[model samples]
Target: MRRLLRLTFRYLFLALLAWVLLSLLLVVPLKWINPPITMVMIDRWINNSSEDFKLRQTWLSWDEIPTHATLAVVASEDQLFPFHRGFDMNAIQQALRERERRGQLRGASTISQQVARNLYLWTSRSWIRKAIEAWFTLLIELTWSKQRILEVYLNIAEWGPGVFGIEEASLHHFGRPAAQLTPMQAALLASTLPSPLRYDPANPANHLRNRANWNLEQQRRLGGAQWLAPLNER
Candidate 1:
């Protein structure tokens, strides 16, 4: 009985040690190295049986993606990205209250949490996925700077079927490069994030146009692109 208990404890310790070391290995290089692919991208590839399915991604250096797209997403998705760590407690609380009132869950994921999920986890909502997402979120918040997190998020976000990153979305949707994305164009792309498959940046509906216009207003309210200056490395 004692020997069995000792072996169980030893195995548990080894497993934990491996997990910690592995997380460091994964999170550290992402500060400088772009991920070649993300788990969700892989998931999409596996599920899509169409011959037309192609992963539309073109990795660009941070400078290659225009500041307009970055701030636009920040305005549309997570207005508090520059200030918060991994989690947004107020947003979470608000979501919980809304859920209680409406009997339906609402997403309160901050950009950092979305980054963690996009890179490491699946899209399915469950207690287990949320727990793992929380774990990755902490490890990332501890290891990566805010700039690195946003860079990864912009690159890996799925804009449409097979469309990933601002660069690809720009070329595919707007016939331009990411660097040349105008404010309105950037806002349009940001608006598609919530339901990329349903919304087309190339041919936006009336609702999408309204959302894009709203995003631009929010971008201005957040002090324009200058709001991101602190995250920029001097």
Candidate 2:
């Protein structure tokens, strides 16, 4: 029993060391030479047999995507995405306060954190999972630029049943490519993000339409993609 325990401990330490070294290596310049990996790929491999959920995503370069799409997502999901480092403390606090008042759970995940969780973790929500999410969020923010983060987020964010990414969502919902999505279409897509399978952009119910319109109004107030134009230049 003692020998078996020692062997298990030794293997665990080695595995952890290997993972740390690989993570560090992934941050190096060589990472640029490799093809970008997104959450969709990881999900397909990890959750292939899961019967309860389905998701499909394709990575699109920043140049291939229009600014309107990102702006729409920002308007609907996280208005302060561009300004925040990784987490949004103010929004988190507000969510916590609201949950306390209502006696229910609420989500306060930022775009960056969502990207981190989607790419590396399971879907279940828990205190331990959230801690792991924070750790991965910090690693991604430190290793990747804002543009890369947004690009990855756009590619990984769920749009509908078996549909992921702006490109797929645009084509599936509106019969348009992501690059050509109008503000209304983009806003509609963004609004469905909260519960993609439940909300249909094709013929959104009253609540969905209202939410989409609200997001569109917010996008207009935020200067509508022009705000993100500079990031593309970088």
Candidate 3:
């Protein structure tokens, strides 16, 4: 019995060590190199399982991506992205309180957390998945800068059915490259992010148009492109 327990403990420790090393290998190089594919894209592909289903994404360097696109996502999704390390405690608390009040769950995932899950993990809502997501989120926050985090998020985010990344989304909706996306066009794209599979940016329904307008207002209030200057600092 004692020998069996010792062997079990040794195997568990080795497993943990391997997991850590593998995660480091996956994350550290991403600081400089772009990911060729992410977990979310794979999941979507497997689930669709149809010839019409396609995964579209284009790799744009940070310079090729425009400020409007970044600002739009920041305004629509996470305003405290530049300030938060990995998680947003305030937003989490608010989400908890709202769940208590409304008896409904809502997400408070920061851009870092989204990047972690989309890049590495499957789309599941188990506590184990959340815990793993938290681990990856911490690793990303520690390994990459704020600018890199947002850049990865923009590149990996699902904008529409089979469309991933700002470049494809821009061209699909507006017939323009991501670099030429105007503020309104960017906001329209960002507005679909919360429900990209459902909302169509090109032919926006009334609610989507309203949400895009609100994002534009929020972007203005957040000091526009200048607000992102801090992300470039380090």
Model 3 pairs in collision = none
Give stretches of model 3 more than 4 Å off: 1-5, 98-104
lDDT of 2 at 195: 70
What are the clashing pairs of model 1? none
lDDT of 2 by residue, 1-234 (tens): 999999999999999999777766654342243235554456655766758755556668878878887888888888887788889999889988998899766789988898877767777778788887887788777777778878878887877766778998988889878988888888889998767878889898999899988998898888877887665543
Q: What global local distance difference test value does model 3 have?
A: 0.90
Ranking by lDDT: 3, 1, 2
**Residue by residue across 19-125, what tens digits does model 1's lDDT show?**
98988888778878889989999999999999999998998877777898999998988988888878999999999999899987788898889888999888888
Q: Give candidate 3's error at residue 40 in angstroms.
A: 0.9
Please report how far candidate 1 places residue 137 from its true position, in Å.
1.1
Q: Judged by lDDT against the true structure, how good is candidate 2?
A: 0.78
- The residue ranges of model 1 lying beyond 4 angstroms of the native Cα positions read 1-4
Off by over 4 Å in 2: 1-19, 25-55, 101-103
TM of each candidate vs. truth: 0.93, 0.80, 0.93
Q: At residue 63, give the lDDT of candidate 1.
A: 74
Q: Assess the local accuracy of residue 210 in candidate 3 as a C-alpha lDDT between 0 and 100.
A: 99
Please give the lDDT score for candidate 1.
Answer: 0.88
